[model samples]
Target chain A: MKKAVFIKEGQVAIKDAPMPEIIEQDDAVIRVVRTCVCGSDLWAYRGDDAKEAGSDNSGHEIIGIVEKVGAAINTVKAGDFVIAPFTHGCGHCAACRAGFEGGCQSHSAATNFSNGYQAEYVRYTHADWSLVKIPGQPDDYSEGMLKSFLALADVMPTGYHAARVANVKAGDTVAVVGDGAVGLCAVIAAKLRGAKRIIIMSRHEDRQQLALEFGATDVVAERGEEGIAKVLELTNGDGVDAALECVGTHLSTETAIAIARPGAVVGRVGVPHTGDINVGDYFMKNTIFAGGPASVTTYDKAVLLKAVLDGDINPGKVFTQTYKLSDIDQAYKDMQERKTIKAMITID
Target chain B: MKKAVFIKEGQVAIKDAPMPEIIEQDDAVIRVVRTCVCGSDLWAYRGDDAKEAGSDNSGHEIIGIVEKVGAAINTVKAGDFVIAPFTHGCGHCAACRAGFEGGCQSHSAATNFSNGYQAEYVRYTHADWSLVKIPGQPDDYSEGMLKSFLALADVMPTGYHAARVANVKAGDTVAVVGDGAVGLCAVIAAKLRGAKRIIIMSRHEDRQQLALEFGATDVVAERGEEGIAKVLELTNGDGVDAALECVGTHLSTETAIAIARPGAVVGRVGVPHTGDINVGDYFMKNTIFAGGPASVTTYDKAVLLKAVLDGDINPGKVFTQTYKLSDIDQAYKDMQERKTIKAMITID
Candidate 1:
């Protein structure tokens, strides 16, 4: 089997690797159908994350078909198409039962699951709890619907998590602080929540256009203080009711905080690059900072899946570029260079 | 008029000061009938907060009789007894209307209203917006009622603000990270909000007693990680639903986050002595960091006031020590030395 491997900083390649097999009672072997490059992947690609080059499996978001199921797996069967949440969990843990599967006590993103989905086959543990079966036959869905289904695995659910935790309401003015796939999807999520006005902070024309198409009412190309100023101006100087900090940089978080109204919530979903949160800045403003890795398994995937099927939201529009598994290197390059908003990978 | 002055970092003295008079259309002159030393005041007394000795007015919490009212002051008039929120606001600003008087547009804690309540007469700006009437004649209430009324000015209201922003819902298990007046009051607030169990972290026997009396179901004397461990153990290892960081130190905030359940809210009302918030710690925990300087003027003062009048709560019990106007130095010393939980100063 061929899987994406990290050769070194600024390098990723598809190489021959051993095939994954069901090793646990709840494990399942899946044939990879679709996968994608997440913003967090760039951390290791850039050598910022402590992940050693050419070590461990890569990629988390996955949409695949169950080729085999372990003895204990009852929820999913062979030949079923499924969406795998980025983080796997044990269904019966206290945290999982409380709807925080991402922080599940039995198995978590930081501790378990090692195979990457950018390959012909992958092993998924706790399949019954970690995988949600897609409704309907694969042949009945359109290509766009398939792409949107792939989003439910990570990006779309993550964006919805941002909007949900920020408490975006029907009359709220929302600001999304990134223009990447998750940020664009957040625009869709905010609109779904009935936001009165949606502002996207983006510097690139393509992303800005995608943002508007996804439901952004306005776009601010400025960065830092200027971007905050633009948002404040649009909000009549009171600032937006909710802000989604989808870019993990300190500046992005600061801008999100600065452009939020008193008592507004700034929900941050991006993998953070910095550890500092200016206590004085948020303390004085009465801002509520909420968010983390999205608990995709806990989100109302059925509702979002329905929305996609019903043509209410096209989160798949974020896939501005796509490539086969053989072109994984180029896909990473396009995404790293900001030449593509997001790259979708088709596995055969 | 006699008022308390900070002669030096470790010194406070009652000395003659100019009598206050209404200077603005929305201003009112109040005769200080009761005032108390706040936990935040200890910051300057301990030389932690930067304050030039004898440089500015001192004290913020006060219960007083309206000595006189400006032409525009409609909510309060001469002879009315009222409780003043520590922070004053214009009331008509967007932030104020949003129930964040601490961040009011026209006037804020950062910009104006420096006159302290530890004086015979103090000028209160935005009188109509900052003052809450006691709903009865001063002579009709008992001494305990007056002390409880004084709590409404800062401690009680600030504690309620912490619980309110933390989103304490019925059946929630709440952990208070401090056991001072504010923390004890937070216990009361949590109970009023229908929290199922309240845990207070405190080593002092007196404070722990007060916490239990105020409705704490458990008390953990441990500090730092040990404290968090105790809280987690008490909650059957799931951690509390809401954590109130009533102590401003970074350790307190970190502990608050550490002991909170995933998706829990850590409400902080302590005047922050540290400016750092570890984004990674909270980001991974899915913790919602909410709170700031309490917008006491926006709180349901009428309900709290009625509670006190009806003997439903005895927040005044936190005021374990009292002093005459001339004993201002002793009051500061006792509070600074932790000999008393809080100090009440009689200005008559």
Candidate 2:
């Protein structure tokens, strides 16, 4: 099997690796059909995260076809096209039942997909609960639909999680604090939730235009205090009813909190890069702070899959550039250099 | 007029002060009918909070007779028996209309009652929206009823804020991290919100009994990690659905977050005495953190007043000791030394 490996800082290589097999009674072997490089992958690529050099596995999102299943896996069968959610919930735990599979009590490393989904073959555990079977194989759908299905594996649900956690409601004015792929998806999510207006902070021209097309009502091309000022100005100084923080830096987190109105919520989906937050800021305004990894399994099984099937959302647009599996290094390079919004990888 | 003054650490005194008069067109002069020493007062009494000695105007809670009104004060008038909430909201601001008057954008010092409600008279600005007029004068109600009304001025509404922020629902299990007047009141708040079980953390025997009387279903007399462990044990290790932080220290706040189940909310009503919080702790569990000063003006007008008048609650029970206005020093001493849960001050 060909899998993506972290060679060292600033380098990722597709190398021949041992094929994955069904190790757990609930596990299944999947032949990867589609995968993508995530923004979080850049953290290690830039030498910011603590991932060790020469680590073999990478990537957490995937749309795959089940090649084999353990005897105990009854829900999914071989030859089934499936979406493997990043957080593989067991479906019965309190956390999973409550729609927070990201914090599943019965979670194991196998459920995390840390073995690298950006490969020709991968092992999926908790298959019965985590794998959402698509109605047909990848060849049955348009290119756009396939990308949207792949998105349900992680980013789309993550974006929706931000909107849900922020308690976005009809008639709310929302401010999104990043212009990355996830933030663009959040714009679509905000619209799906019926937000009256969405002001996205973006400095990149292409990203800003994409955000507008994705349902952002306005854009603020500023950063820091200036960005907050611009957002507040757009809302007539009342700040936004909900703020979506899609960037993980301290400044981004602070901007999200600052842009929220009194009694508003700041939904932070970005992985935090900073240590501590001055909670007194939220306390003084009575702002609600909530967010974490997307409950992809729950959302996919509940709404995202149906929404995608029904054409209610087209998250596939986030992938501005695509590449064959052999061009993996170039895909990472383009995304890292800000040359692409997101990179989609096609496997053979 | 006589009013409570901070003499120094461990000391408070009743001294002559200027009589209050309607200073703003939206102001009203309320002759204090009843007042009380607050738990927050003990912070200053213990010299933990910065305060200049001999500074007058100490208390914030009051149920009184409106003695005079500025020309614009039409909602409340002279001779009207009123519950002057600790936060005097203008009622028309965005924060107030949203039921979060504690962060009212139109706030002024007069609306805060920082001039002192323990005095013979208080000049309450934002009177039109800030004061809740009772049906009759103080003489028409029993001492218990008056005490309940006084509780609505701050503690009861403040406690209710915690439960409201925690999003407590019917059949939910709630954990309260403090056992002071506010925490005990929160026990009642949780019950009123239809929580199936209420766990209160209290080491004091008297307070534990009082908490039980106030609807606490269980008591954990432990502290720190052990306290969290006990709470988890009470909930069968799933942790409470909602955790109320009535104590503002870092440890208390951490305990509230630690004992909540995945995706639960930690409602903190206590004024935070610490600086920063490790937000990652909350992010990991998708726990919602929401709280601040009670929107006393909003809660009192919306529900607390009716609840008290209907005899649905008797928050007055929190006042375990009584003191003549002249014995202000002893009142502070008793509350500081933990000799009483709360002290009621009577003005003659």
Among the numbered candidates, top lDDT falls to 2
Q: TM-score, each model?
A: 0.95, 0.97
Q: Roughly what TM-score does model 2 have, to 2 decimal places?
A: 0.97
DockQ of each: 0.56, 0.63
lDDT per residue, candidate 1, B1-348, as tens digits?
A: 988877778888778889988788888888888888877776778887778767544688888889899999888888998998777877776677777777776775553443467888888887887888888776888888888989988889789989999989899899998988999999999998899999999999999998998899999999988888888899888888899989888889889888987778889998676556766556777889889878787774546877887888899999999899788778888988899999998875
Top model by DockQ, which number?
Answer: 2
Q: What are the per-residue Cα lDDT tens digits for candidate 2 across B1-348?
A: 998888888888878888887777988888998899998787778988889977854578888899999999778778999988888777776677777887787775445544466778888878888888899788899999988999998899989999998989899999999999999999989998899999999999999999898899999999999999999888777788899999888888889988988888889999887566867556768888989878887788778888888988899999989889999789888988899899999996
Checking candidate 2 for backbone clashes, the offending pairs are none
Cα deviation at B54, candidate 1, in Å, is: 3.4
Q: Where is the poorest 10-residue window by lDDT in model 1 chain B?
A: B107-116
Per-residue lDDT tens digits for candidate 1, residues A1-348, read: 988988888888878888888788888898888888877788778767767666643678778889999999989999998887876867676567756676776775554443467778888877777788887667778878888988888889889989988988898899999988999999999999999899999999999998898899999999988888889888888888899999888899889989988888998998777557756457877889888878787664546877887899998888878999999888888998998888899975
The reply for model 2, stretches above 4 Å from the true place, is A108-115, B108-115
User: Each prediction's Cα lDDT score?
Assistant: 0.83, 0.86
The TM-score leader among the candidates is 2
Error of 1 at A113 (Å): 6.5
Candidate 2 chain B minimal-lDDT segment of 10 residues? B108-117
